[model samples]
Target: MDVPALNQTSASLTLFCLPYAGGSAAVYRDWQTRLPGWVRLKALHIPGRGVRYEMPPMHGWPELLDLLVEDVQSSVSQPFAIFGHSMGALVGIELAHAIRSRYGHAPIWFGASACKAPGSRERKLDWLSCPEEEFFDQMRVLNGMPEELLQNREFMELVLPILRADFHLCGSYELRDREPLECPMLVLGGSQDLEIARSSESLSAWARETRAPLERRELDAGHFFINTHRDTVISLVADSLARAFHSRGSGVLPSRSYA
Candidate 1:
């Protein structure tokens, strides 16, 4: 398995971290420190990100899910959890369904942050066909990309393809009718995240996607709540994972000594 930092410790649960659009596995490199010792953070390295920069980024949902499923199967020997933010949240939802259908087992827990539930809204942007200047203008308003990258023409040239590909996938998303997930789901959002315009009621819509009771939380922050409230996010994740282990009859999660 190409699982990073696998043999370093004795972990009982594996947490698969998915990044948002224009993001890579490296985004969660520091997450393990805040997680419990029994949980191992395996950040999913999607194509065209980080070390895989040489490869082209995926542009469609089917192809992306197929590739992800193949990569994830190799690490399914142990109990695992799934976490994603923004665009990553959408990927996590479909990926969970795929994993259960293929491997016959759902993740112990699913964590979705700062994203609208699939099919909840009909708003669409022609991101794939949008002119570079217009798209860049939108990115500036959305504030998802760094100002430095947007200002640097060369940097923009290099990242624009990946950004457009990601947005294309996001814009083209159409949720299909399917069975709800069997595991407990934790839906989190920012109180002031204008990007998604998510409210408590809107966040609760995720309940339709899970058979188990859904847990919803809102951080007193903006769109990027995970970074703004890292401590709170990590605490919630650890607590949710612990409960998941307990529910699966895996017993309680082991206590960790954080230095």
Candidate 2:
């Protein structure tokens, strides 16, 4: 669990992103171009998707975590923050705990999107076991996947399994009662996402537990707020990072307002 030292030369901060279930690092590939020069964005690519298409998908949370920590350790070296949505949100939270326990340094910020706080009542629609058409319908309801892709048979064939596996992981996750994080937490929710209930209040609970700065913003979109509000989301993230850095040092970039 010992976290490796963050890269000091590349930039002052790095952002380690975790994708939604059935997603890949490719989702955030363009983020580097969008973020400020001082921040480096790196997306954690879960196997069995994208570049690792041949590998089998992960079935359990612990197994997935072990794989992820190893992968992240190898790919990242700088003082970094974590941003995860839905399934990725849980990963980010657990990863922060792991890094702190092992490396002794918590991330400067933790951005959790589209997920309720840990220990919330489980909502088990079970996309993995649902019929193909029904499963896609569920995704459409959540507004995560694109409309064009929904009708593309070939695309669905390629992406559906990964999505199912991710849903399964999220469905199966069991929270271990633990203390709240000490790092600043930012929770984002989609105003129209029905799949995740009470996302704002649940995420806000993190503030009470961590006793750290917690802010919740509801976007006028569905579960995939990152897609619909990319620029706005990125700007908010940049502002948060600026504030975190400014608090850490005497002078840094001035914080900007969210759109």
**Per-residue alpha-carbon lDDT of model 2 for 161-229, expressed as tens digits?**
788888887777777766677667788888788866544466556565465788788888888888778
Candidate 2 backbone collisions, by pair: 1-102, 6-77, 6-78, 7-77, 7-78
TM agreement with the true structure for every prediction: 0.89, 0.84
Where does model 1 exceed 4 Å of error?
A: 1-11, 123-125, 198-201, 253-259
Residue-level lDDT of model 1, residues 4-55, one tens digit each, is 2222254487788899888888778888888866787888877787988888
Candidate 2 to truth, TM:
0.84
CA shift at 157, candidate 1, in angstroms?
A: 0.9
Total backbone collisions for each predicted model: 0, 5
Model 1 per-residue lDDT at 233: 87
lDDT of each: 0.80, 0.74
Mark the 10 consecutive residues where model 2 has the least summed lDDT: 1-10
